[model samples]
Target: MGKIRIGVIGCGSIAKHRHLPEYAANNEVEIVALCDKVEERAAELAKEYGARSYKDYEELLKSDDIDAVSVCTPNYLHAPISIAALAAGKHVLCEKPMAISEEEAQQMITAAENNNRKLMIAHNQRFVPSHVRAREIIESGEAGKIYSFRTSFGHGGPEGWSADGKDSWFFKKEQAFIGAMGDLGVHKTDLLRYLLGEEFTEVAALVETSAKKGSTVDDSAVCVLKTESGIIGTLAASWSYVAKEDNSTIIYGEKAILRLEEDPAYSLIVQYQTGETVKYELGGIQTNESGGQSNSLVVDHFIDSIRQDTEPAISGAEGLKSLRVVLAALKSNETKKFAEI
Candidate 1:
């Protein structure tokens, strides 16, 4: 019950940038082991963090000293590794798009539930300061009766962020399953669900592999989502923004138009119907840029959940709900119709 012993099951970009460092910084956690398919990668990180290393995730999960694991692997490997980690009596903090299919996400949830361990999805968007404030403002009726929204998350692509650069598993359809939608769109979807407190019940989308050359997976996607209460919104996810990253959300409501992460100076801006404009200088949203390393709070929250023996804020069920919206968007693209979630 001292520091929660942690194992990170991927030595990739996300692990390097977010999980590993965040967990190491937390006073309640210890970086116990590192795992990756590439032995050198795992070994290097292990040496740096003073932790054990394993080329095989299964081997890493066998250690009883490890109380929790961050499943930072490719999308295809997320479900299996997390399920295994849960079965091994360790809490799991899985990366976004927790599974490629609903069945797999359900199985992960079932495994965690059966094992009586915590399962949290690493949807750090919810932990963004502006997002948290926006949710509060919306719930307090500051944005009274939401009408519509437009949110986007884009950048040059994972080539600049992935550990393998242009050769990362992110561009492969088999490994990533879906690219921008799963990578970026799901964050917005989850954010919207959190901010609005409603599940997306239908989706229509145009998903394509348009931007990245020679890539078999989608690099851009635009989705039209309808919430359970008839609130509609557009979500754009792309790897084609060659200049810079854009992670912004604009919500239109009866009393105000709330903008999040849209201004360079202010993180949240609210323009009321009464001509009063309020701007908030909350901390910057985390980006793939060189020095935009804001604390995402995902790793800390996961550690707290384990320590307190409580369900994580972004639990498996919440992740599954977000995943379903992404899956429905894919289905809508394939079927050329509105897909009900």
Candidate 2:
């Protein structure tokens, strides 16, 4: 009850760069164990954080000293590890796209419900200052009813981050399910939903593996989405951008258009039809690390939620809603038509 004892399920790049460091910074949390299939990686991170290491996630879950866990494993392992952690009576923060399919996502939700534990998805974009500010402005009727949006996220690929480069699980269909859609696409999809305060009801999409040859999953994809409230938007995500564009979203409304960029240098801009424009200086908003400011904010939110016994900003149900959008996009691509949510 003093400090929330935590365990990390995967000692990969995300864990090392984001979750581990953020957790360590939070005085309310104490990292107790690190787990990874690669024993050396787990040991390395454990030594760095002054925590115990385990090759088996199950062993870490069995530890009574651990009150919560962060699941940073490959896409396919998300649901299993999360379900196990919840069933073990630990609060869980699972890295996004929630799960590859709706069925798996449902199982994770049900397990958390049955165990009465907090289940949050790491859709860190929701925690970004620019995004949070945009949501506030939109909700205040300052934008005057959002009509449309365009968003994108792209990068050179996982080669620089993953230890195995193109051979990493990100390129494997069995492990990752979909390539760019699950990786970069999910973030934008969730962001669009968050900014608009609407759910995606249908999607028309196109997907390809043009950039990364021999990759089992898609390397690029674009989708058109129709929200339940009649808002329309486009989302494009790719692992093929030559110089790394990160993520950005533009929202159009009757009175103004708001533009948000992950790059702090440009900050966020809102242009009103009445010939007035306002810009926010987001000095520390961008970073070379994946998720960047969003990750740190999300980790802080999770720790606060555990301490306060409140639901997270991005709950399990919200995560499932975003995953449904991605799945619908994939289905639309395969069928070459609009797919309903």
lDDT of candidates 1 onward, in order: 0.94, 0.88
TM-scores of the models, in the order given: 0.99, 0.96
Q: Pick the candidate with the highest lDDT.
A: 1
| Candidate 2, position 46, lDDT | 93
Write one digit per residue (lDDT tens) for candidate 2, span 1-341. 69999999988877888899899888898999999999999998899889999999999999999999999999999999999999999999999888988999999999988998999999878777888889998999999988999998888888667766767889999998889889889988888888888888999999989998888999899999999989998899898887756688899999999989844565689999999989887644444454543445778899888889898888889899999989998889889989999
Give stretches of model 2 more than 4 Å off: 262-264, 284-286, 289-295
Candidate 1 runs further than 4 Å off:
none
Top model by TM-score, which number? 1
Tell me how candidate 2 scores on lDDT: 0.88
